[model samples]
Target: MTAAPRPKLSVILAAYNCADFVERSIRSALDQQGLSIEIVAVNDCSSDGTLAVLQAIAREEPRLRVIDSRKNLGPSGARNLAFDHAAGEWGAVLDADDALQPGALGPLVQIAEEREADIVAGSIRFFSHRRQEISGAVFREDAPITALGLKDFVEAARPQNREPDYGLLKPLFRIGFLRERALRYRTDIRHGEDFHFIVDALGAGARYILAREILSYIYTTRESGLSRTRVDYSRMIAETEKLARQAPYSEDPMVAKALTRRADALRMHELNVLYGDATGLPSKLKVLARSLTSSAGQRWLKTKIAKRVVH
Candidate 1:
């Protein structure tokens, strides 16, 4: 009898101070079925017990490879390092703080191969540490997984805005596709790096398929995490403006509409933050003036004028 061949996948788990949740995240990647999985657990010089936890896990699981950095590098640097060390046919980016559901990887691999897709996305369910067994406030399911079908699914997911805020759907990617396109997370931006990365992949003519059958990711919301910080509204507004101006969807009507909606939503959220009670009078006044003087502000004004004139 012949033995089954290993389907190679490189799973990169970028860790930085995720000690409390890193174990679960690694286990999820390790649990993947029907694949020759190499887990690259890169520790970005976490001050917490993340490195120790990763070491313990690595000792237990032969597939889990730990890269403990001497100095603190951000998520982008960690991910890049992991990818550099990974030797697999496919690559999956797994956040250190998140968990993958059972039997998630096989479906994505199947869908990507069957559809000849460069990228395959699956559904995600959000959960919070505080709310035990409460499911989540938001869960998203992408379109049906058919051969070469992603336009409708992309349209449906466009307005979700923040990439990581929603797009944890699936985690199977062709390593060759990333290497060919030279797609790496941008290290400069803190808030919207994933968004920028996705746009880059899309612009590079990447093909997409949906893993519609599986719940591939479990995204956790822990209040103690970095996500709970107050936003720099002025900076975020600028980011939104840049996103609108630079998104490759300027020529695609549906995508353009979705981008516009996302821009508006982000601007509105930031505006509230700028004007919210937590802000002081001088800061509020400065932000207000900046908002009115911004390029986005000018664009908004022109759009309103054009709408009224047309109406």
Candidate 2:
């Protein structure tokens, strides 16, 4: 008898202390129909029973490959390791707490092949585990497919925009495109790493297209997620600053404008932190004065004052 062919897509999942949700995530990937896919899961030295859970699942599911890490490599490192071991032409990221919709990979792969795109993304539905309900879709549904270049992506990521970050939308990327460009998530950044990776891919001139027709991914907003537990304003500011400075298209006028907007948002975050930490009236005044010194701070102050007056 002939052996089964290799999967066309590899779903890389970096799991850390996610024993409660990892099994469901793996099962979701395995349940994907109409496509040949493999789940490459790496347990990053999870303090919980995540490793044992993964190992047990792997024994039952042949397509699920589990890697046990000796040290805690975090999400980026684990994902990089998984990428090296993946044998698929296309790669997809699946968070341990999240799951993919049925028939997700087939349509994404078709789009990538048809357009010769390096990245093919679709809408994501945000599901609140606490509420036990899916909130809504992330991407706009008006267009069938929206093509984006580096400049366009940067602009859409601006703070003033109501649209969701394209990074939050799970994308099916060509393995060759990522390997050829040496695109990997930065291990240094704890938060906003996904955004940085997406930016880097776009900056490296990867063709990105959004398929608005299908909401293929479900992003579960769990109470245990980093966004809920971590509030490191300074680290976030530094990451955004680094992104602006190191972007390949930093010299472009449009990219520059987007960077400026991001910088302004960072400044606003700083001002908010300062104000929140102020103990007394004098301290609050000092914080306000310091915030008003910079152009971004001045705008933030004006906006705050405007809201107060309106109320």
Candidate 3:
């Protein structure tokens, strides 16, 4: 028997307790036109009805497949799990709480084809529960950016910029390229797994494409999953630091320097979160003491004071 045709793209979606939004999100993927797509969603041990929502959609939608995990494997683990079952040549990350903009895939796929890029990072927009566009795309561009390199990626991702963090942008990946390099999301960090994955791909010499104008990924500002948990900034720091110590990442002196700067910025974020989470006078005092005594913390304090003065 002839095999059924493969999908053009597989949406690597991992959802947790997002039952209220998961159905809408899955329908959005199903409603997409001009592309034959398959949705591979993993239910990461959600306490809510997220798994039921996924299973319900799967039973009705032939293109949608749901996997129920025995335990919570975090975002990276769940996505990695979905990817293992993907049958498409290309892949795109979709959050369970977010929906894809209509007709978004065509232009992204076009850009990838024309540019011969393995990855395509598109612009993002925001929405709310009221079905309102809370904010527009992250960039205003009439054309897409191509041939973006490691140095560019690192600098764009650096914290404290007017531009949104590049790491936050979800880019489409060529499944073959990722498989060629054995590139997969790092399960260690929850907050910055995309950044780490993209870095690994770029380091492995995959061609990068940037779509600065196409708002392909629509992000919802709902408080769930990662939003519900306290982010460990140190995980991001350690992951970046680990990359900085590796060969291809650290080989380029300038790239290595950029990684160091990024790590420092992450350290600042770590200190700020700790300070904000500190409750009693003793804990607060301890944070202040650490900031006062350490060089990295001193820089953080200086930046903190600088921002306060500026505002």
lDDT leader: 3
Please give the CA lDDT of all the candidate structures. 0.67, 0.81, 0.82
RMSD after CA superposition, every candidate: 5.8, 2.8, 2.6
What is the TM-score of candidate 3?
A: 0.89
Rank list by TM-score: 3, 2, 1
Scored against the true structure, residue 191 in model 3 reaches a CA lDDT of 82
Q: Which residue pairs show collisions in model 2?
A: none
* Candidate 3 lDDT by residue in tens digits, 119-174: 99788877765656558667877764767898889877867756887887888999
List runs of model 1 lying over 4 Å from the truth.
1-7, 134-143, 146-171, 222-237, 243-258, 272-311
Writing each residue's lDDT as its tens digit, candidate 2 over 58-94 gives 8888999988999988788898999988988999998
Worst 10 residues of 3 by lDDT: 222-231
**Which sequence of candidate numbers ranks them by lDDT, best first?**
3, 2, 1
lDDT, residue 298, model 1: 52
